[model samples]
Target: MSKTITLLGSTGSIGTQSLDVIRAQGYRVHGLAANSRVEMLAQQVQEFQPDWVAVVDEAAADKMESLLAGMPSPPRLLRGPEGLIELARHPVDAVLNAVVGIAGLGATLAAIESHNDVALANKESLVTGGHLVTEAVRRNGVHLLPVDSEHSAIFQCLQDAHSAKTLTKILLTASGGPFFGMKREQLAGKTRADALKHPNWNMGAKITIDSASLMNKGLELIEAVWLFGLPPEKIQIVVQRQSIIHSMVQFSDNSVLAQLGVPDMRIPIQYALTWPERVPGPAPELDFTTLKQLTFDVADEETFRCLAACKKAIAKGGLAPCAANGANEEAVRLFLEDKIGFLDIGRLVEAVVDSESFGGTYTLPDVYECDRMARSFVLAHI
Candidate 1:
């Protein structure tokens, strides 16, 4: 049976690579979505010819329609958040959500409600509304395959181990980002260029900044807990600079199992697309002979305040994670725009999280309110 896929954020790094994997495996690309970047999306449409497309920017949507003027049957174009949700709920085998930030929440909810399996690369979706998402999955019987490398690794490691009772802990690995050891004083005047220079992966500016602060790993920590049904304490973050070993799972019997591969999103993407049935892809083979060393160390929570903030959020429960994620998103935006320094990013998030009221509720509205409150708090602080 040919699997049908609806790809959200079809113009970004993960989206493009996911399409590459889909093309290589002959999966049907039923829908494509992006925030803007319609030119690249148009190129994807020309190659794969999905049935529908959604653009966040109206101008880009118009341009996309114009670019595909001569197709035998051009895709129906959608504009704005409503259109993105509509494309997400379209009857498809899987929705590969690669769209960044909190904007991805609605589409994710739509996919889950429609009973479509999700290939989730959007960390904020899980971070902001982990409980809500898990409930939706249960109500709809939809499987969420993690498209992020670390979570994907944990997913692969748990294939043979079904019982959560047997699991002792989930060990999530981080690349430690660019400024792994820099002090807050040193990062006071860092440029966007410095933060964008990720040591392990090439990604979008927002996510790149998240990586630099270890906030990406922080978000992933909450995400892993929700995905794996593990307690917050059961999840540990270790800095693995080589990026060879993505993540690990430890059993109660003192045995550790890890999934290792070269730092490529395609491997995980292909796995999620063909989940429960692995297929070959064009990703580079992990040559362990040449890859001699894999070093692991405790994350420096003192230096990278985001990780500690995430720990507090998870411990606080309820809407704290949502607040943290929302504040971080605003902080990242500010940093990218040269309105804030690198160290101020975490400071901004911490301040908002510290001030937000935790209702101990995980409903969609509660999460959304927390996000709004956090963003507002951050803006006011700035």
Candidate 2:
């Protein structure tokens, strides 16, 4: 039987790689959605011949329709967030949400509520709306698979565990981006070009920036707490310069299991799409002959303040993570636009997390409101 999937952010790094997985595994593409990259999305639609397509950018949707106008058969096109949500609600075996930011939260909830298992690569789905998403998973009885490499490794390591109580800690690994051991002063003068050069992974601009600031790992920490139902303290971020050891989990019995592999996004993407069953993947196998030493170091929380900020956010609970995420997004956008320094990313996030106060039980709307408040604060201050 062929599995049908709706791929959100079909033009992104994970999205494009997911298309490769779909092509390799012979899965059917039921629907596709993207933000402003209509050209790439149109190309995917042409090749995959999905039943439906959505472009979140209205202008891009208009252009996409024009681009596909003369085709013998074009997928039905929808526009805006409503279109993305509608695409999520479309009946499919799974929804691969590779969307980059908090914008992914809605489609995640929508897919789960509609009884579709979600292959989630969007960290914001859990970072900002962890409680909401977990509740929906329980209520709808759907699988929320992790697509990020670190979380997927931890998920894979825990598959045979008898119970959650048997796991003592999750050792989340980070490649430390392009500036692993750099001090704050060194990063202060770094350019966007310098920050975007990730040492291990090829990723989107926003995520690359987050990785440079170590905020990506911080966000992942919060995400792990939600995805595994573990407390913040139970997760330890280890700086693994090699990127080979994706992540590790320590058992209560003192044995640690680590998932090792090449630094490839498609591996985890494929795993998330085809859970409980491992299939042949396009990523290369780890060769012991050519492999060198795998070193681990303590994450420099003092230099990369965003890591500490995220730990604080998790402790504060409520809208703190949401605020931190929103502020970081805005700060990264500014940094990319040449408006802020590299170090200012953490400064702005810390400021927003400290000043904002949207704590307590939250609804979907409340999450959005907190996101708006944090963005507004960052934009005004910047």
Candidate 3:
């Protein structure tokens, strides 16, 4: 009865924590994929001993394969994005896709088409290809579990016997990033180091920077619309700096339900993997005794223009979200590289999104094309 899980981006924050969950629950690691970080991937392979391993970094793959030469039995190594896509289609029961950017979309589709249940931490997959991912899940009749904390909390809240008809709205929570109450003028001179310091959660540099600008929350907003099948208007963003209350749902009866926990990623990651059957884990349980009061406020859309632009993208639909994801990825990279200010990240995203035309219905080609176009546009503008 052991679950076999394929972990994409196995060296990352979510992927590493998922490995912890698998280790704790005695699940099997079927396949592992990562971009670069061969040393870490090699270490993971030594421990997990997956059936297959993929490295998106060609040079790193060479290094990893050499490192595993002495193993009693090493997983067959695959290279590049195509390799990761093939890994997703491997004969595994589930795939934990933790790849960081638009790079995850292909793997996500591959998993779905192969009828592998997906534990999705890659928001860009949903944000860029919401229609395609949702439709494929429906056609293939596979489980698309949300690994992000906000979506996972909403998924948990929906487990209540109440019907979707009884649901009134979804209240998505945000930690308000590092610059929560800071005005535009106050944040203009902030450095990359400043933006990378998140008050609530430990995360990678890119995601931490995204969180600081509230762009992470904005991306999550679009992701929630797709995952929960709720109207963009029906979803509300709450700035909860504590990161305790992950998310909430308000039913038609005016009753509000929420999922509260420590800021640990393991809680949601474990939930997604062992869903419908919560297995016990060593993930830190929230302690109410030492906990302080939880506070909530409306996000400053004026300062956090990315949040507003996300709402616009959702309204526009189709390739708009895809373009937004692409543009945001570039802008975020520039911000982290110190090529642009934190505020300019949002400015660049807004510019790219505005510059792109909202095309007709999305095909996979359309999404990728739009993503490339947006990236090009953002690079030129920045």
Residue 342's lDDT within candidate 1 is 89
Model 1, residue 256: C-alpha shift (Å): 0.2
TM, every model? 0.97, 0.98, 0.98
Among residues 3 or more apart in sequence or in different chains, the pairs in candidate 3 whose N, CA or C atoms overlap within 3 Å are: none
Which parts of model 3 have CA positions greater than 4 angstroms off? Answer: none
Clashing pairs for predicted structure model 1, backbone only: none
Q: What ordering of candidates by TM-score runs from best to worst?
A: 2, 3, 1
Better of 1 and 3 by lDDT: 3
lDDT of candidate 3 at residue 197, scale 0 to 100: 85
Cα lDDT, all candidates: 0.89, 0.92, 0.90
- Residues 286-321 of candidate 1 have per-residue lDDT tens digits of 997898788998898888888889988888888899
lDDT of 1: 0.89
Error of 3 at 225 (Å): 0.8
Tens-digit lDDT string for candidate 3 (1-382): 5899999999988888989899998999989999999889988998988889999989988888888897899999999989999999986878999999999999999999999999999999999999999999999999999999999999998897655558889999999988889999999999988987889788998899889888888899999999988899999999888889999999888888899989999999999888888877868889999887999999988899888888888888888888888999988888878898888888877887787568678799988999899989888987
In candidate 3, residue 305 scores what lDDT? 85
All predictions: root-mean-square deviation over Cα?
Answer: 1.3, 0.9, 1.0
Q: Once superposed on the true structure, which residue ranges of model 2 sit more than 4 Å away at CA? A: none
Please list the residue runs of candidate 1 whose C-alpha ends up more than 4 Å from where it truly belongs after superposition: 162-164
